[model samples]
Target: MSAQFSLDNAQKDGNEPIWTVTQLNSRVGRLLEASFSRIWLRGEVSNFTQAASGHWYFSIKDERAAVRAVMFRGRAQAVGFVPRSGERFEFRVTVSLYEPRGDYQVQVDSMRRAGLGDLHEAFLRLKQKLEAEGLFDPERKRTPVQMPQRIGVVTSLAAAALRDVLTALQRRAPHVPVVVYPAPVQGADAPAALVEALQTAGQRAEVDTLLLVRGGGSLEDLWAFNDEALARAIAASPIPVICGVGHETDFTIADFVADLRAPTPTAAAELACRPRADCLQAVDAAFNALTLRQMRLLERASLRLDRARAGLVSPRQRLAQQAERLAALRQRLDQAAARSLERGVGRHATLAARLERCRPQVAQHQRRLTELGLSLQRTLEITLQQRRQKLAALTQMLEALGPNSVLERGYSLTRNAEGKIIKNGLDLKVGETLQIEFGRGSAQTQVLATHGLL
Candidate 1:
């Protein structure tokens, strides 16, 4: 059907243009849609119905007026809860008119319980804020005590959560003592009371593990656990806290800040301590292992002892053995001494015979020495005569080559004042004193002139 339509197109008797019911309803619906975009409406639900096709048909009304609404399956599926009669809700819808019945209605895009939207928004805002502060950091979270000595519970005494926790602890860890710090789990004063209880448990420092627990409820009922002060208290607790608030699907700020989050109160108690039977079994196993190890060590020590006993000897017997060894050594020493003395005597006799054989003939040597002396004298006399003859010849040659001989041959040696013999006229300096040496004597003179010999 075309959205653009005009009553002027069809005329009746030219009196007045008229529109069909379909045309009128379509035009009115379009006008309503154009006038208002999607809007949020708050009213109590009435005459709610769900079709097989998963569409929701309902009526929303205040005290004086009511409006019919329909939500398609796609949008209805996104809504978390079913709409019930008499329940207030906020709907995001478009105003429209049904063409078939010409009835006015709203096409709902989404819906939620009236007040829950605000609560959810607050929850999200707090979650985001705390997450920004690292309260939800996994690294900062502590591991719950595996075997707590004592467990503390922070819950109202009359609460079902307290009963569940106590029952669980009794079943899993009866040996572990449980201390309950009474506090209100819900109501306006619950947050403060819960904070006080947690702070008290922390101050006492009596328990290694603490359980912050509450039964499942609506968001408003569980809002106490979402308080900022309560979350900060849980984070500041020295003891490891296991927060069990509401059901598994329910989450509060306490759960994020706690050291551990349990899906239920019973789970928190179970996680706080180990089972007593399991602990006993572990202890027994360790004892058995230690006993077996000790037995093995003892057996090894026994074997060593037995060996030592077998090798042990009495002091007297040990001394007798030492004496026998000494006797044998003494006999061996005596034999060695006797053999050494005999060898020494034999060596001495052999050396004495060698000395006799090597003895010098001193008397014969003395006679030989006298003979050698006479021979040496004769040789000395011959050598002296030869030396004397050679000496006389050398003397004659020397006398022939001597300056005195030259002087006797009518030659003279001239010497300068420095007593240096002048062999040539070039050696004579004018006006220099000279000494003339002849065979008979040396005379001092002065030279006035010099001449060169060719």
Candidate 2:
């Protein structure tokens, strides 16, 4: 009998213990969990699938074997990038067993691209070292030459990059001279050869700008440009260096340390030498502008000259015109004097008539003023007397309503300690504090006993 069948048989016989399929699977899962908590697995991924419930299923494989794996939605969402088939990665996972099928698998937690770890670490280390030494400071970078008189190239003569650069330079600035300092741009000896070429070019001082260029390639193929020695050499060169080592996305240590970085060798040449056609166009435009300005200036000068010529006159003519103006001014002054004399006489006669008319009115106004003054004095005296009488009546009314008047009439006022007037004796308790007011004085007292209630 099979083990499962025999276990059932034993359970029926009641001679030995038996385990169900569920129990067996549960025990195996517990054992797996107990034995292996978490592990790091390095492998290539394949057969990846994302379920509707957002769970990820895949297999990780190496040369010899493969194992199924899954990443639940929660953990998978934590990954920064999506995973694809056939990509190698290092995964942090937990060993697990699916109970229903009794299948072994790993639950992945996180992942990172494989093979890049060591290279990335090394790249970072060198970058940090150079940056700490101030090799990448903006202040240390040399200013790029605007239009170089001569450009020296440091690259392999066999490289396509060389042809691209030469073609660009020929097309852009044929007037500028180019010197090729041939050097290997790949393999083991490239860094050393490049350094030697740069040093030689520096010593010669035949070029104002230097271009270090190479075609695009894989990171490993372009590793020579990442060399620390190469970077330092580029930084130390007296001639401004423009590095175009790879495509736009590829960055190397030389790119950081060089005076300027271009996307490709052709671009570097274009930068170092401006286009001849563009220069000619600019010169033409400037000449046309200057010519127009000169023409406008000449026209303005001519207009001014014409105006000046038109205004020219003899000294005698100017003197005759001034004499005419002086005669007119003298006539106007004489006319004004005569009119002033006539107006003064007329004003004196009018004033005499007005004085005669106003004399009688003035006397009549004086009599009316005297009458008003007497009336005002009588009214003020009567008002003063009436005010005195009203004040006396008001004083008498106030005295009748005042508490002092009541006190003077043989009545005493009682107030509590809080200054509240007491209206009835029954409102007070024995030993309560009170104040008694009389006409002339006041006294503090205590309620010794109760009185009759109203």
Tell me model 2's lDDT, rounded to 2 decimals: 0.88
Q: Which residue ranges in model 1 land beyond 4 Å of their true spot?
A: 1-40, 43-88, 91-115, 318-454
Query: Whose TM-score is greatest here?
Result: 1
lDDT at 30 for candidate 2?
72
Candidate 1's TM-score:
0.50
> RMSD of model 1, in Å?
20.2
Give the number of the best model, judged by lDDT: 1
Candidate 2, residue 10: how far the Cα is off, in Å = 62
lDDT tens digits, residue span 53-143, model 1: 9999989887789999999999999987776665678889899998899899999998777754445667889999999999999999899
TM-score of each: 0.50, 0.45
- List, in order, the clash count of every candidate structure: 0, 0
